[model samples]
Target: MASELHEAIFMAKQERHKNLFLNYRNLNNFPVELLKDEGMQFLERLFMKRNSLTTLPENLAQKIPNLIELYLHSNNIAIIPQAIGELVKLQSLDLSDNALQIICPEIGQLRSLRHLRLANNQLKFLPQELGDLRELETLDVSMNLLRTLPERLHQCVSLQCLTADRNLLHCLPRQLCLLPDLNELSMAANCLTSLPLDLGRSMELQFVFVDNNAHLKGLPSYLYNKVIGCSGCGLALQISDMKQLCLTLGDVTVPLPSEVKAIGSESERVLPLEELACRVLHAAYDWTCKDVKLRTPFLMPKSLLDVVQWPLGHCHRCSQPMFTIIYPKLFPLRETALAGVHRSTVSFVAYCCSSRCMSTFDLQA
Candidate 1:
């Protein structure tokens, strides 16, 4: 019955119409039990887009082996069949907006695939075998939860564009630079803290998308020439003895000497605020004196304070914040004078202005 229905449609196409449109005909849900193997032998293009298909018929490619393009977007598919590799003449495959969790390793066998779209899926990782699709030119896997990419991606020598934004990746595969034909690379909204040292060394790389990742610290030095937003000014170099280099770009903050996996313990790289202030002041001024500004609320050590501001409970006399008062400067002290009286390094200690009545009471006490 299904074969007769398809035959009738083709007969109609040949009788009165040179072209026909048969989209969204609810053909995906039918069980017409036709001799599909021989009927669809010459079928080259199939559009099953926007359906409720959870999986494709296993013998589909075997029947329509000459198929070149397939659109199966907007489905509930959780897995792609390994038999997809048999579509030797396929040039494009759209599997976007699906619930797919894994990419079949056999997909790499489609050497003739030029465009592949797997965006808006639940994939956490990609098969390294995809790098074998040397004829692939466009690949889009946006809006997924990928963490790390396979280094074998460099094998796609003919790949010219790759879009992988809105993922959880912390870093990129360094081997990406080996793709001499790559022109565009998008890696936005990831946990990236820094780029590989040789990222922009690729002369063919023309555009890059690295925004929306506020925790990202630095870009490769050579990338300055290609990046328009940085104005070619890459990570500023600073000399310091402390392991971490703290930099405040307006309200956002980032630390250098980025987190690295060493032995067993994970530690935060920290730099003293005094050293940071000295560097900032010395860079613009000709003065030989290395002056460290008195620390304030902004530079409060995270070790001592769990919150941002000093609470009134820490004060002895007043129920308000003491020490480190923010007033018109009468020459900020390099170190608080209260440092001599109280131990604990006197993080903050300021004397409240005494009133005439309070002074008389203080004399009596």
Candidate 2:
């Protein structure tokens, strides 16, 4: 007696189906049964989400060479098969909530791909070849371990929306601003210190979310015309810029950056940080300050103060604790108050825990 899968396969062959839906199936392994027949030759879309798939079937390209959209969300997929590159016609691919560690460079072969989602994965670095996906428009790499993006990404001229929130990136690629079609960028909860100078040149850009980056004092001069989300941050932007901000809190009370010692030592070589216990704390600690006029900010977790051996306070402008509780640091955000005369300010505030991002004193409390 043929099983349900066999029946489905028979139906697909008989009807010459183009779309296949097999979601919510307690599938432990790829259903090789579906590929044994020639009927799948016409298959273009495949939905197999909510399954227990640990890995993709070998030779998936051989079975569904004509595939366009593939949905494999909520699976235990640790690695995408190299054969994935074979599906040249693939456009939309969803591999969210998987255990993937890295994206295969072969993905660059998908010239027709438009949308790609890799959120909620363990990816440490992306393959530079991904820039070859010229047709890609929307990309979500949020909640990953990415420290930097490939500069080659500038080649993806069609990108419209990019979301890279909750990553360890300390800076962004300037090439990102070269794209003329990009419209929206969500980079909240990152360690970015500054923005690309050409950010204002993108005619299509309309929305940006860069809040929660403690060291980011304000947008580049060019972005002053656009209103973006900027709460829980200190800025030197004019009051007009603050007023234009998107905030859930009543009014935007933007404050100046913390005090800065000098720009010389600030330009020192970069240092690697141990995996941060919390990126939120790291960014916040860098911007919290007792005096709103200061150039450096200090927002630290109380629990971490002792572990890092940071003193209560010292080098007030540098936010550097008296002791040797050091971590990776970035150049301070230089704010010019004249720019934000008409800005809106918010009252949302938090005190620093130790000096610098590890402030010892509470600025707000």
Provide TM-scores for the models.
0.58, 0.64
Worst 10 residues of 2 by lDDT: 341-350
lDDT against true structure, model 2? 0.64
Index of the highest-lDDT prediction: 2
What is the Cα-based TM-score of model 1? 0.58
- The per-residue C-alpha lDDT of model 1 at residue 74 equals 81
Query: Which regions of candidate 1 fall more than 4 Å away from where they truly are?
Result: 1-35, 227-365
lDDT of 1 at 32: 29
Against the reference, the lDDT scores of all candidates come to 0.59, 0.64
Model 1: lDDT to the true structure: 0.59
**How well is each residue in 248-362 modelled by candidate 1, as lDDT tens digits?**
7455454532222221443422222332232233232323334324232134354233222222112122222222221111121224453233333333221221110010001
Error of 1 at 357 (Å): 51
**Could you give candidate 2's per-residue lDDT for residues 1-365 as a string of tens digits?**
22776677678778989998888877888887777855277889999898889988767888788899999988999999887888989999999998999788999999999999999999999999989999999999999999998899989999999999999888899989897898988888888777776775666887777766656644565554443544311212333322232212223233322222222466421111221222223333334555534523443343453323323123323343322221122111124342122121111112222212311111111
